[model samples]
Target: MELTSGIRDFALTPDELSGFHARGYYGPFKVYEVDEMRRAWRGERLRLMDREYAVYRSEAAESGNTNIANYDRHLDSAYLADHITQRRITDRVTSVLGPDVLCWRTEFFPKYPGDEGTDWHQADTFANASGTPQILWPDGAEEFGGTITVWTAFTEANEETGCLQFIPGTHQSMFYDETKRMHYDPSSINRKEKDGVRRGFFGYDYRQLQKDPDWTPDESQAVSMVMRPGEAVMFWSTLMHASLPHAGNVPEARMGFAARYVPTSVRVYPDTEEIEEYGGRVSLERHGSVLVSGEEKYSHNRLVDRTTRGHRFVSN
Candidate 1:
């Protein structure tokens, strides 16, 4: 794939890097002009619905469930494939994850009018719902391993539209055990309230995985991330994060596309053949991690050089 020197831009400065380490998050950075993002989304959204080249082509994936159906569209949509490898996103990610980084996964999070907010939670192994370790790090590495998630706003994200909420510095510790089990009940969705807020973890209760049943996230420490269309934020996957419920004051739904990144040393979906979660299942037969930056020193994960439609991924 041809690459441009522009990919070298957007690296986090020293101060920004230190702040990210201290706060576990950074930026409502601008990735695209608002009109540019809106225009792109308008066209891409229509193209994405086709899904002929998507890796997870299954009945369950198209069943209207929010989970599997909204995953890895980058593998099919050229626009989304380019979005994931955008220098604005990958440069900042590599700033934190070192030179060699891989775009392991991507998912679309949409909050419709009156839909319940995402329950506050942190993920390490990412097995909270699937009961399978999604990412594994080698021994002698950090005590905990988590991917860097870059969440870009495709639509306006405001207080009424259910913007993301984060508790600073919470990435250093685990409040919920990923190994713990969380029951999935689709009927429970948008039907429960937690600490007086309407929230649910997709179809599961994230509270079920709490290390301490009585423990609660300190709302006093939480901050809302209000973003404009084309804005993006990067945070550690283990950061205590959630969102507010859409108040239905707006006509449009809030859409955030999250691209997950990890160093080449980390294994993506180690020993997994299929993903069964959120009451949906998809095979990994066509799965491949996109090396977004630097070299791939590890062979533990499958790598794809192009989108299923033959769009080349931008990489050095």
Candidate 2:
């Protein structure tokens, strides 16, 4: 499949949709030319430093774990705000999630040279890290409750640079239970291993919450998502996925921007006001999920029409 100008011509064909449901993931589809993505990041990185309108509290934004600190820029940055609504990303996301969708979260996954690979895991309520049910689907939709994640590579992602890897068709059943508790120790960041691989879940070991301590994810079916800058992959948040350790000798880091989408029927951050996790805490006073497509008929969550910079969030 060839790349098209986003929004103008980028809906998935029937076969593409079928493949996505069967495999639980789809694409290293092109969103921007390698050079185009590289150029955009060069300038945007500087503007991102000013996060005055960022939704998270100062403590959360300054957490020792960079992933937590880099959460949800789409709520503040114009570039990211526009990004979550892109046709190439949103159209496909809506296809899986249905027309009325809300982008409840965005995160930056950055892996520096020699950093530990992400532990193989999946998320349902996203309570794995925070120990709080962040999203709740209605009873009828409970069977498929996880969010749809569109992860875009903002930099080169390869085996050596800690690219993503996935075990196909594993979205149907979960190996780990989010309700189980996992101790968060910031010192454990780069100092853990599972099944012999040097990996850790930011500050927690994912295996702590495994449904069966004796059961481990089979790594034999893993496929590396080596992508050029600007390419993206869409997957169920419950899919068995992990990443390689950044072993490259280069100083450049791998950056994957992930925007999470869910249907309007789902309640985001249900009965939660503060996110306490990863050895830190953040208040959600300023947090608001953006409507990326269709319309919102529910009043369960706060909605934002513009970014902190006064940039409008255009809904498709």
Which candidate achieves the best lDDT against the true structure?
1
Candidate 1 C-alpha lDDT tens digits along 206-228: 88898899998999999999999
lDDT by residue for model 2 (1-316), tens: 0112234357778999999999999998998899989999999989988766666756656644445668878877888888888888988887788778888988889899989999999999999987789999999775797899999999999998999999999999989889889987779888877778778888888889989999978799999999999999999999999998888688999999999999888999999987777766778777778877777887787777745454343332
Cα lDDT of candidate 2 equals 0.84
* Model 1 spans > 4 angstroms off: 1-7, 310-316
Candidate 2 runs further than 4 Å off: 1-8, 63-66, 310-316
lDDT of each: 0.88, 0.84
List of clashing residue pairs for candidate 1? none
- Alpha-carbon shift of residue 150 in model 1 (angstroms): 0.1
TM-score of each: 0.95, 0.93
Candidate 1 matches the true fold with a TM-score of: 0.95
Among all windows of 10 consecutive residues in model 1, the one with the lowest summed lDDT is 307-316
Q: Which 10-residue window of candidate 2 scores lowest in summed lDDT?
A: 1-10
Who wins the TM-score comparison? 1
